[model samples]
Target chain A: MEKKKIRNDIILAVCVLAASLIALAVFLCVRARGSYAVVLIDGKETARYSLSENAEIEIKSENGVNTLKIENGKASVISASCPDGICTAHRAVRYGGEVIVCLPNKLVIRIDSASNGGVDAVS
Target chain B: MKTKNIAFIGLLCSVSLILAYIEALLPPIYAAAPGIKLGLANIMSVFALYKYGAKEAATVCLIRISLSALLFGNPWSLAYSAAGAVLSLAVMILLKLSGKFSPVGVSIAGGVCHNLGQILLAMMVLKTIGLGLYMAVLAITGTIAGVLVGFCASLMLKYLKKV
Candidate 1:
């Protein structure tokens, strides 16, 4: 390989490594603070539970297709019929960036600060 | 003007459509963000950038996104895809004209631009600035994917010249 090729490879490797470390750090910090909300399909506040205090709380959406379980300061989609089942893999969203979304069902489980002012302005 | 050139562009568009459809089938790794994609179809766009010109590449990119969205049955995705596609194409055009980088560099620039455009659209649609944080992750992934696709395109161009 040429000198430039080697240099580019090294740079790419560094970028990837740096990204992995940053993602890990963010995940850890988010997991450390465990408070989240469960919003139902009917636009009602289905449940607001803190992971730190709850041993295990089951939050069922009004449609009943979506259910979330909060335990040990972590929230996860315990069950859903949303085809892809990606929400289940999301495990628990403890960080500001982590989100569990079920599009077909129009349900979103996100982690936001109580003082973030208000629910996200978009959706 | 040349049949070969036209054939090549056609091939690139078809490849992009295939990539887009394959990506669509991959079961979104994240649920809430159903429309969020890795922009894998960009491989063809990057290829066209070097094989044809930036304008031709942009045309191919737009057609791929539109056709893919139409086939996939999500007109809403068009707004975000178009924003990203157009911005990425413009960035690639500028980079290609600068003569500072090779096709690979242009591809990387295009990928980064695509991610930034998508993030901007997300922030606008979601009405949430928090989505900005996701940009960091997208940038990292975009660059990596760009390099891979760029290298592939470079190889193809090299072979085409030999023929």
Candidate 2:
């Protein structure tokens, strides 16, 4: 019984660890420096800003409001009216394909690569 | 359900709710990871699954999620939690039915699937796939949280069996 339990533990640990490592590798490979921060509300493009500009934009959605700040080529949520404040706690994102999500406000700030023409595609 | 079963489910629900409340009061486990949670409430779900069955476990989980959301979360959070609960329960049930894995394994799968479900819902809600990057971090945290919750649950099950 002890041996079987140990084997099961080893198998599960290896499987989960391998999966997480693969995901981590994918994340590292896909992330790249971004040029624009695109804000989407309810899956619609609401605003876009360049990373070079240092400014704070107030995003007011039907649910609540959030303050997004872009500085030092990174964008992050400075403050939010939502309860969890997960978005505000998220680290600044400057890499393409990185996002700061405010679920309560249905707000998303996604960094897009220069090559992808992220917000430009919407325009 | 029999009165006994219903009462057990209610007890599980309240226990899970209290655990969630305690978790909320605790500080984030890691500053680098914004949304990582201890998932301590999952102990009740695992215990319910082993003690009663999947239906009872799901009932306990659903009630806990809805009540917690009503008390402390917003509508969007409700959506995320609902998605996570549904997916996590489904995975855990399937793993349990396989009989190849222990409660600890099932709980690990449950924890990882829960995070995956939430991230998928977020991606859909935001209309962007970029959030998928966050899963890499969440998966690791989920595993650690899962092991802790699983051990607690297994111990509880062992003690309850004697009772």
Candidate number with greatest lDDT: 2
Candidate 1, residues B1-163, lDDT tens digits: the string is 5887788788888889998998888766543332345667887787777777877888789889889879984654677678788888998888677655666666776776787887686555543444444566666666776777678778777877743
Question: Which RMSD values do the candidates have, in order?
Answer: 5.1, 2.7
Residues A1-123, model 1: lDDT tens digits: 345644654464466548755866675665435355545343334456655665444445443386777666667787786665656766576664455655445466666545441544334
Off by over 4 Å in 2: A1-9, A61-63, A118-123, B1-6, B29-34
Second chain alone, TM-score for each candidate: 0.88, 0.94
DockQ of 1: 0.19
Which lDDT values do the candidates have, in the order given?
A: 0.66, 0.84
Best by DockQ: 2
User: What TM-score does chain A of model 2 get?
Assistant: 0.85
Cα lDDT tens digits, model 2, B59-160, are 889999999989877787789889988999999998787766677888888898898899898878767666655777788888888888889999999988
Candidate 1: C-alpha RMSD to true structure equals 5.1
Docking class of 2: medium
